[model samples]
Target: MAAAQGIYTWDSRSSSYSEIYARVRSWWELLPDGSNPLFVLVREFEATGVTAGSFAVLAEQFSRRSGTAQAVRCDLELAKVQEYPAPWDGLHVCTVTVQVVDESNNSRNAYAAPVTVMINCPPAVTAPTGRCAMVGFYATAERIVY
Candidate 1:
Protein backbone atom coordinates (compact mmCIF):
# COMPACT_ATOMS: atom_id res chain seq x y z
CA MET A 1 0.00 0.00 0.00
CA ALA A 2 1.07 3.57 -0.58
CA ALA A 3 2.47 5.34 2.48
CA ALA A 4 0.65 8.64 1.93
CA GLN A 5 -3.05 9.28 1.62
CA GLY A 6 -5.52 12.13 1.33
CA ILE A 7 -7.65 13.29 4.23
CA TYR A 8 -10.79 11.24 4.75
CA THR A 9 -14.11 12.11 6.30
CA TRP A 10 -15.59 9.84 8.94
CA ASP A 11 -19.15 9.00 9.87
CA SER A 12 -19.61 8.04 13.49
CA ARG A 13 -22.78 6.11 12.80
CA SER A 14 -21.27 3.81 10.15
CA SER A 15 -19.01 0.87 11.10
CA SER A 16 -17.37 0.92 7.67
CA TYR A 17 -16.02 4.40 8.35
CA SER A 18 -14.11 3.09 11.39
CA GLU A 19 -12.56 0.22 9.45
CA ILE A 20 -11.45 2.42 6.58
CA TYR A 21 -10.10 5.01 8.97
CA ALA A 22 -8.04 2.41 10.79
CA ARG A 23 -6.62 1.04 7.55
CA VAL A 24 -5.56 4.49 6.46
CA ARG A 25 -3.88 5.15 9.79
CA SER A 26 -1.91 1.95 9.51
CA TRP A 27 -0.40 3.03 6.23
CA TRP A 28 0.85 6.23 7.77
CA GLU A 29 2.37 4.37 10.71
CA LEU A 30 4.58 2.02 8.70
CA LEU A 31 7.97 1.20 10.27
CA PRO A 32 11.22 2.51 8.88
CA ASP A 33 13.72 0.47 6.86
CA GLY A 34 17.04 -0.70 8.35
CA SER A 35 19.24 1.69 6.36
CA ASN A 36 19.68 4.11 9.27
CA PRO A 37 21.01 2.22 12.26
CA LEU A 38 21.42 4.96 14.80
CA PHE A 39 19.40 5.52 17.97
CA VAL A 40 19.08 8.26 20.54
CA LEU A 41 20.47 7.87 24.06
CA VAL A 42 19.15 10.23 26.70
CA ARG A 43 21.26 10.59 29.86
CA GLU A 44 20.26 12.56 32.90
CA PHE A 45 22.98 13.79 35.23
CA GLU A 46 23.18 15.96 38.31
CA ALA A 47 23.17 19.62 37.32
CA THR A 48 25.35 20.74 40.23
CA GLY A 49 28.68 20.38 38.42
CA VAL A 50 27.82 19.56 34.77
CA THR A 51 29.13 22.00 32.20
CA ALA A 52 29.49 22.32 28.44
CA GLY A 53 33.14 21.31 28.70
CA SER A 54 32.24 18.00 30.35
CA PHE A 55 30.03 16.62 27.54
CA ALA A 56 32.91 14.88 25.77
CA VAL A 57 34.05 13.10 28.91
CA LEU A 58 30.52 12.01 29.72
CA ALA A 59 30.01 10.68 26.18
CA GLU A 60 33.19 8.63 26.36
CA GLN A 61 32.22 7.12 29.71
CA PHE A 62 28.80 6.22 28.34
CA SER A 63 30.35 4.51 25.32
CA ARG A 64 32.60 2.41 27.54
CA ARG A 65 29.82 1.34 29.86
CA SER A 66 27.52 0.47 26.97
CA GLY A 67 30.08 -1.69 25.09
CA THR A 68 30.67 -4.29 27.77
CA ALA A 69 30.88 -8.00 26.90
CA GLN A 70 27.71 -8.91 28.81
CA ALA A 71 25.93 -6.23 26.81
CA VAL A 72 25.78 -6.64 23.03
CA ARG A 73 28.38 -4.30 21.60
CA CYS A 74 29.07 -4.03 17.84
CA ASP A 75 31.44 -1.17 17.25
CA LEU A 76 29.09 1.14 19.13
CA GLU A 77 30.23 4.74 19.12
CA LEU A 78 28.97 8.15 20.19
CA ALA A 79 27.83 10.06 17.14
CA LYS A 80 26.95 13.45 18.66
CA VAL A 81 25.32 15.27 21.54
CA GLN A 82 22.11 17.18 20.93
CA GLU A 83 21.87 20.88 21.71
CA TYR A 84 19.23 22.29 24.00
CA PRO A 85 18.27 25.77 25.13
CA ALA A 86 19.03 25.25 28.82
CA PRO A 87 19.31 22.67 31.59
CA TRP A 88 16.55 21.80 34.02
CA ASP A 89 16.81 22.56 37.72
CA GLY A 90 18.92 20.00 39.60
CA LEU A 91 19.00 17.91 36.43
CA HIS A 92 20.94 18.08 33.19
CA VAL A 93 19.53 16.24 30.18
CA CYS A 94 21.92 15.06 27.49
CA THR A 95 20.71 13.48 24.27
CA VAL A 96 23.22 11.62 22.11
CA THR A 97 23.17 9.45 18.99
CA VAL A 98 24.72 6.01 19.29
CA GLN A 99 25.62 3.89 16.28
CA VAL A 100 25.75 0.09 16.24
CA VAL A 101 26.95 -2.36 13.62
CA ASP A 102 23.43 -3.58 12.93
CA GLU A 103 19.86 -2.96 14.00
CA SER A 104 20.25 -5.13 17.13
CA ASN A 105 24.00 -5.60 17.01
CA ASN A 106 23.12 -8.84 15.23
CA SER A 107 26.32 -8.73 13.25
CA ARG A 108 28.19 -9.74 16.40
CA ASN A 109 25.50 -11.91 17.95
CA ALA A 110 22.36 -13.89 17.24
CA TYR A 111 19.96 -11.76 19.29
CA ALA A 112 16.92 -10.43 17.46
CA ALA A 113 16.32 -7.46 19.77
CA PRO A 114 18.44 -4.68 21.15
CA VAL A 115 19.68 -4.96 24.73
CA THR A 116 18.81 -2.20 27.18
CA VAL A 117 21.64 -0.99 29.38
CA MET A 118 21.67 1.61 32.15
CA ILE A 119 25.09 2.78 33.29
CA ASN A 120 26.06 5.34 35.92
CA CYS A 121 29.35 7.19 36.12
CA PRO A 122 31.08 8.58 39.17
CA PRO A 123 30.33 12.17 40.05
CA ALA A 124 32.77 14.92 39.18
CA VAL A 125 33.28 16.76 42.43
CA THR A 126 36.58 18.54 41.72
CA ALA A 127 38.24 19.67 38.49
CA PRO A 128 40.47 16.61 38.46
CA THR A 129 37.75 13.96 38.17
CA GLY A 130 36.94 15.08 34.58
CA ARG A 131 33.73 13.06 34.59
CA CYS A 132 30.09 13.76 35.27
CA ALA A 133 27.96 11.51 37.47
CA MET A 134 25.14 9.83 35.57
CA VAL A 135 21.96 9.48 37.57
CA GLY A 136 19.92 7.73 34.86
CA PHE A 137 19.89 6.72 31.19
CA TYR A 138 17.39 5.25 28.70
CA ALA A 139 17.66 3.81 25.18
CA THR A 140 15.93 1.14 23.10
CA ALA A 141 16.99 0.19 19.59
CA GLU A 142 13.65 -1.19 18.48
CA ARG A 143 11.83 2.09 18.88
CA ILE A 144 14.41 3.88 16.79
CA VAL A 145 14.34 1.19 14.12
CA TYR A 146 10.61 1.48 13.88
Candidate 2:
Protein backbone atom coordinates (compact mmCIF):
# COMPACT_ATOMS: atom_id res chain seq x y z
CA MET A 1 0.00 0.00 0.00
CA ALA A 2 1.19 3.55 -0.76
CA ALA A 3 2.32 5.41 2.31
CA ALA A 4 -0.84 5.96 4.27
CA GLN A 5 -1.60 9.37 5.63
CA GLY A 6 -4.45 10.66 7.74
CA ILE A 7 -5.23 13.57 9.98
CA TYR A 8 -6.80 13.09 13.35
CA THR A 9 -7.98 15.52 15.97
CA TRP A 10 -8.20 14.65 19.63
CA ASP A 11 -10.42 16.12 22.27
CA SER A 12 -8.52 17.55 25.20
CA ARG A 13 -10.82 15.61 27.50
CA SER A 14 -9.30 12.33 26.27
CA SER A 15 -5.57 13.16 26.21
CA SER A 16 -3.35 15.85 27.69
CA TYR A 17 -1.83 18.47 25.39
CA SER A 18 1.65 17.38 26.42
CA GLU A 19 0.97 13.94 24.98
CA ILE A 20 -0.12 15.50 21.70
CA TYR A 21 3.08 17.48 21.45
CA ALA A 22 5.22 14.44 22.21
CA ARG A 23 3.42 12.51 19.46
CA VAL A 24 4.10 15.28 16.99
CA ARG A 25 7.81 15.27 17.80
CA SER A 26 7.94 11.49 17.30
CA TRP A 27 6.30 11.82 13.88
CA TRP A 28 8.68 14.61 12.97
CA GLU A 29 11.63 12.37 13.66
CA LEU A 30 10.29 9.83 11.14
CA LEU A 31 10.33 12.28 8.24
CA PRO A 32 12.48 11.07 5.30
CA ASP A 33 14.53 14.26 5.13
CA GLY A 34 15.66 14.73 8.71
CA SER A 35 17.46 17.88 7.69
CA ASN A 36 14.19 19.76 7.43
CA PRO A 37 13.89 22.48 10.01
CA LEU A 38 11.58 22.13 12.94
CA PHE A 39 9.72 25.14 14.19
CA VAL A 40 8.33 25.05 17.68
CA LEU A 41 5.67 27.28 19.12
CA VAL A 42 6.05 28.63 22.62
CA ARG A 43 4.13 31.31 24.39
CA GLU A 44 6.10 34.50 25.12
CA PHE A 45 5.39 34.03 28.83
CA GLU A 46 6.49 30.41 28.60
CA ALA A 47 9.99 31.31 27.37
CA THR A 48 12.85 31.10 29.86
CA GLY A 49 13.78 34.20 31.83
CA VAL A 50 16.77 35.27 29.67
CA THR A 51 16.85 36.77 26.17
CA ALA A 52 18.91 35.31 23.28
CA GLY A 53 21.62 37.96 23.61
CA SER A 54 21.94 37.32 27.35
CA PHE A 55 22.15 33.59 26.73
CA ALA A 56 24.94 34.11 24.16
CA VAL A 57 26.90 36.13 26.68
CA LEU A 58 26.48 33.44 29.32
CA ALA A 59 27.74 30.75 26.95
CA GLU A 60 30.69 32.91 25.92
CA GLN A 61 31.75 33.35 29.53
CA PHE A 62 31.55 29.62 30.15
CA SER A 63 33.63 28.92 27.05
CA ARG A 64 36.20 31.47 28.13
CA ARG A 65 36.77 29.68 31.43
CA SER A 66 36.85 26.20 29.87
CA GLY A 67 38.04 26.60 26.28
CA THR A 68 41.67 26.44 25.08
CA ALA A 69 44.20 29.21 25.59
CA GLN A 70 43.51 30.42 22.04
CA ALA A 71 39.86 30.77 22.89
CA VAL A 72 40.71 33.01 25.85
CA ARG A 73 43.13 35.02 23.75
CA CYS A 74 40.52 35.47 21.04
CA ASP A 75 38.13 36.93 23.60
CA LEU A 76 40.75 39.40 24.72
CA GLU A 77 41.10 40.67 21.16
CA LEU A 78 37.35 40.62 20.67
CA ALA A 79 37.02 42.89 23.68
CA LYS A 80 38.59 45.46 21.41
CA VAL A 81 37.41 44.66 17.84
CA GLN A 82 38.65 47.95 16.42
CA GLU A 83 42.22 47.01 17.28
CA TYR A 84 44.21 45.31 14.50
CA PRO A 85 47.09 42.80 13.97
CA ALA A 86 47.03 40.40 16.96
CA PRO A 87 48.55 42.04 20.01
CA TRP A 88 52.06 40.75 20.88
CA ASP A 89 52.37 38.84 17.55
CA GLY A 90 49.72 36.26 18.36
CA LEU A 91 49.25 33.18 16.12
CA HIS A 92 45.60 33.81 15.24
CA VAL A 93 43.99 36.92 13.78
CA CYS A 94 40.33 37.91 14.14
CA THR A 95 37.64 40.58 13.68
CA VAL A 96 35.02 41.51 16.26
CA THR A 97 31.63 43.26 16.41
CA VAL A 98 30.09 44.82 19.46
CA GLN A 99 26.63 45.94 20.63
CA VAL A 100 25.63 48.11 23.57
CA VAL A 101 22.42 48.17 25.57
CA ASP A 102 21.56 51.19 27.67
CA GLU A 103 20.11 51.29 31.16
CA SER A 104 16.57 51.47 29.78
CA ASN A 105 17.23 48.26 27.75
CA ASN A 106 17.72 50.25 24.56
CA SER A 107 20.29 48.64 22.24
CA ARG A 108 23.02 50.22 20.08
CA ASN A 109 23.89 48.02 17.12
CA ALA A 110 27.30 48.05 15.53
CA TYR A 111 28.51 46.62 12.21
CA ALA A 112 29.05 43.34 14.11
CA ALA A 113 27.95 41.49 17.24
CA PRO A 114 29.07 43.09 20.51
CA VAL A 115 31.62 41.41 22.75
CA THR A 116 31.37 43.24 26.04
CA VAL A 117 28.94 45.04 28.31
CA MET A 118 29.77 48.11 30.39
CA ILE A 119 28.18 47.83 33.78
CA ASN A 120 28.78 50.02 36.80
CA CYS A 121 29.15 48.39 40.16
CA PRO A 122 28.27 50.06 43.43
CA PRO A 123 30.88 52.62 44.36
CA ALA A 124 32.36 53.36 47.79
CA VAL A 125 30.37 55.53 50.15
CA THR A 126 32.31 58.60 48.97
CA ALA A 127 32.27 57.65 45.28
CA PRO A 128 29.75 58.51 42.53
CA THR A 129 26.92 56.31 41.12
CA GLY A 130 27.44 53.94 38.16
CA ARG A 131 25.70 52.27 35.17
CA CYS A 132 25.71 48.79 33.53
CA ALA A 133 25.41 47.16 30.03
CA MET A 134 26.02 43.94 27.98
CA VAL A 135 27.76 43.09 24.67
CA GLY A 136 28.08 39.98 22.39
CA PHE A 137 31.11 38.55 20.52
CA TYR A 138 32.25 35.78 18.18
CA ALA A 139 35.56 35.17 16.35
CA THR A 140 36.93 32.81 13.72
CA ALA A 141 40.56 31.72 13.58
CA GLU A 142 42.46 33.24 10.65
CA ARG A 143 45.87 32.46 9.13
CA ILE A 144 48.80 34.71 9.92
CA VAL A 145 48.78 37.73 7.59
CA TYR A 146 52.50 38.30 7.68
TM-score of each: 0.21, 0.20
Q: At residue 121, what lDDT does model 2 achieve?
A: 24
RMSD of 2: 23.0
Could you say which candidate leads in lDDT? Answer: 1
**How do the residues 1-146 of candidate 2 rate in per-residue lDDT, one tens digit apiece?**
00001002222333344553344334332223332234421121012122334435433333111111111223244544335532222123232222212121233222222111111123322112452111111121231111
User: Taking the tens digit of each residue's C-alpha lDDT, what string does model 1 give over 72-111?
Assistant: 3211232221223212222233333332221111223121
The Cα error of candidate 1 at residue 128, in Å, is 12
Q: Which runs of model 2 end up more than 4 angstroms from their true locations?
A: 1-7, 30-34, 40-146
Candidate 1 C-alpha RMSD relative to the actual structure:
21.2
In angstroms, give how far residue 125 of model 1 lies from its true place.
9.9
Candidate 2 residue pairs in backbone clash = 97-113, 98-114, 99-114, 114-136, 115-136, 119-132, 120-131
